[model samples]
Target: MKTQNQFQLFKERRFLPYFFVQFFGALNDNIFKNALLTLIAFGAFNQETRELLTNLGALLFILPFFLFSALAGQLADKYKKAHIIRYIKFVEILIMGCATIAFWHHQLALLFVILFFMGSHSAFFAPVKYSILPQYLERDELVGGNGLVEMGTFVAILLGTILGILLIRIHTSTLFISIAIMLTAVLGFMTSLWIPNQKTISNPDLKINWEPFSQTWYVLKRAASQRTIFLTILGISWFWFFGSVIITQLYNYNQDILHGNEAVMILMISILSIGIGLGSLSCEKLSRHKVEIGLVPFGSIGLTLITIDLSFAHGLYPEQVINVSTFLSHWEGWHILIDLFFFGIFGGLYSVPLYVLLQSRTEEKERSQMIAANSVLNALFMVVASLFSIALLTLGLSIPQLFLVIGFCNLAVTMYLYKLLPEFLMRFIAWLLINCIYRVKITGIENIPEEGPAIITCNHVSLVDPIVVMASCHRPIRFVMDHQIFKIPLLKFVFQTAGCIPVASEKENPEIKERAFALVKEALDRGELIGLFPEGSLTSNGNIQQFRKGLERILNNNPVPVVPMAVQGLWGSFFSRRYGKAMLHWPRQFLFSKIGLQITKPIPPEEFNLEELKNITQNLRGDWE
Candidate 1:
């Protein structure tokens, strides 16, 4: 089946209703929270008490996720997600009713209680909302669906914050805020009703853990059982920590560093939010509709570099309040904005993939539990970040230095993760090379086995052929490469990390050829897939070269199902020798070129032959250039 862009999912019944449900939920959340902040800031409380109350307000809202997420996760896994969502919305309406009453009477006590309940409501809803995506959308649509959800959420935050500010400044401020919160809750409930039912994936008889501390520990243990899941959760939490520190300091950054007022702060926020939205939406296209973890590292690099630059850029602006118009008129302001924009871009790139990875990898029964664990850890990380920032600032570190330290810390963390998980970096290089030069469309990817050993045989089209094929494959591939080309400078590192087996013509290097064959045999024996370019080298012309006999030798030893794959639209590219010596020619016509990889049904071991594989690959790659 052909893959569809993420936006197309919106037209389907499965995604649209849920999108609105989430959108409205986030809108109501930010509306109430921001409104509370405004009131506490401007209300009769003294300045010292106001700071305490505002911090308390933030804590109350986040505390529920810490206290109740374990229970929420259990309910989400044990019952229909749609049902849980509807019931949660019903609870939200009640919470908003309390909020309305508190606002009407201007009772600080009841308002704090309402805030705590709102936080609780969000905590319960968290696992259900995230875990429900994998249930409703196809695997290919995960990134896109997540992108839209994130974008919608941020947009809601932006709009809701603005609305709350406007409401509190009005003549009948209390009345307007009360009515807005209630009406939004009702609308959210209405949308939740339209969300399609998603049946529970966990056991109905599973015991519900009511003890938050022990249950939370149990939940975390379950997540840790899956190493990648646990690491990614940590990764996600780290992003939150990094982001919270940055955002919290932005208020100070606006006043002390940028020498700007609230208007300049808004400008910074707008640029960052817009950048994230764009970055998130672009993931589907950048990843070619797959959950490419490579983007995670790619994003981390951007995050580090841009953050470092931001530290330098902030120093260029003088410490005096600059109007928004004047801030834009200066190059220093533009530099700061650029840094913030790319920071959001990399942040989006960092987050979207990991979230999709969690959804795609977690067992359906434990998915909600896993998400709840993530929520709890994320909250913990943010809280820790606040304390860390305060300590750093107290130690005489300027805001810019704090950013610099975070950036340096980010580099250290990412490098450690990459060393632990080389797959991340390998995939990053593959994704980077492919996306930087070519737009690839892959079809029949499902024809490859989801698990277990299989042989993938494709026609060689360019020096970068293996990288392209690697990027397209969902599972890691052990490619067999010519020893000479395998030793090429920078490409050697990527090839070595990817586990490419180096071979030479038996006449020239008999021992190396034997070792290559032996390695392929062992990989297949271990239930791992090996990708081979049957034509054995880059195509000198724009046509498929004849297959070599290496496949026959490998299959003779270990008979395995062989998938015939093909690459088209790369013959004349700079990497291919179609124009002249590959890599020597400047990329005049190859920049931003589109390419395609097509896979046909697997040929049984009993039916496979060298000549037959060649014909099949050629036909699959038909008539491109």
Candidate 2:
């Protein structure tokens, strides 16, 4: 039986310890960094030195990624990750000690050094943090796991940033702040102790390469070989770029443009953070905990459109520059806030799947290296975004204009990527159609094998039948379809990319029929679920046709369990026979159609009598005839 409860995911020891460790790590990092930034802005450095110090601080933080990430990736692959994390936390304590001295002496140089050390700690920790996810999770749990991690990280950042600023303003002793950081590090270290020893998957006998840049590049190239993984990495990097640009610009927008106080800054960040948290949680609900990455493009489109809306809402230099409170008092501010929230929501939708894809698809031995490569990409993109922001400001563009540019750029990048990989766009279209237009309720999904090969037998009722099943199935499926349908102008690209098998009737094209069966057999042999409509063709009438014999041949040869399934409530729709001449029909309601899927228990080959299975499927289908 499958469960959807969030707490149920933590019952396994493999995830909980790591979860706490990561959560606290994020919390502490944000707390200290925000505190340091506040000190610099307020009094730690004079205005003349503040800009240089702040930029240097940013450089020092990202520098470790460029300098130590390859070595970090190597270490994560060389030893047990639990031990490494423990040692890293201990180093964090020592770094905090340095922070205490810096605060006491009011030494800017010492503070910068501590910040660099903190970044170095994060650099070393990055590879292990992400790479260990796959080892602890089942493939099905990957999405949920990644969602939780993302949610936790963002929540921690939000809270820590808020508290860090708030706490420093209380006029508390500097020693107290130092103590808080130390205790947080200790707690994180203790949590690390609870993580079970995960052995190194890659025991590279070769000595570590010290040339970090070249070594990191080589690792990235290796990760780029897998098409899906490579695309996912790009997707993740794009997310960081998008997010960093928005959050960084938001500070200036709030302070200078909106004339808002620190409270307003907190509010904007809080809304974005909460939206991401909700969106991350929504992935489990929307996908039913399966890693359905097709949602990525949908998220990207939403994000881009909302950002543009936000830009327009601000308008090009309004006559009155409203303060934060006054802006909120007006309808326009509320509109912008709503837009920002949804932006975060869609942002959440975009990121969760990429994390799952990386975790589930990468080779275990090099998982850490791959994650390090991902971190490197994230750092690189962030740097580029920073540079872009600086350049845009230098070009005399206002903050709002920069926002507009980034948002439009987001649309361009997403479109180009989707054009290159039509599967993403197709899946997005299918997923949106199913979720928004049809209320897809499913039963007996468990009958579909959790792992390994199985044959899915269904009634073919429409041209889009395969897509309906694809959208609902928990796992990926290769569908056998009519060759002519596969050749439809724009759709041929999608069908081919999805690797759907195209077949002609034996009487029509014997060679195509033979090739189709061969592909089906090969897919099943590789433990992939293959879907075939036993009717051999869509019914011209709104009823299930007589069962075909191909399903029998498949089961006899492979001897795997057979899952019988059906789709109800689609017959009267435009895609069905009820529409005039089928393919000529247009979409019925823009956003309200009824659809349902039901599955019967898997019948072993020995128990699979074709007539019996057909009758059982008919009964389960409940008179779709």
Candidate 1 pairs with clashing backbones:
none
Best by lDDT: 1
lDDT of 1 by residue, 160-223 (tens): 7667756876779888898889888999999888987764456476788888999999999989
Model 2 CA deviation exceeding 4 Å by range: 1-3, 10-13, 40-56, 170-173, 198-211, 313-324, 488-494, 552-560, 583-590, 605-608
Error of 2 at 394 (Å): 2.1
The local distance difference test score of each candidate is 0.84, 0.79
Worst 10 residues of 2 by lDDT: 314-323
In model 1, what lDDT does residue 211 have?
A: 86
Which regions of candidate 1 deviate over 4 angstroms?
A: 1-3, 40-59, 105-113, 255-265, 312-335, 439-453, 482-489, 502-528, 535-560, 568-598, 621-625
Lowest summed lDDT window (length 10), candidate 1 = 46-55
RMSD of each: 3.7, 3.2
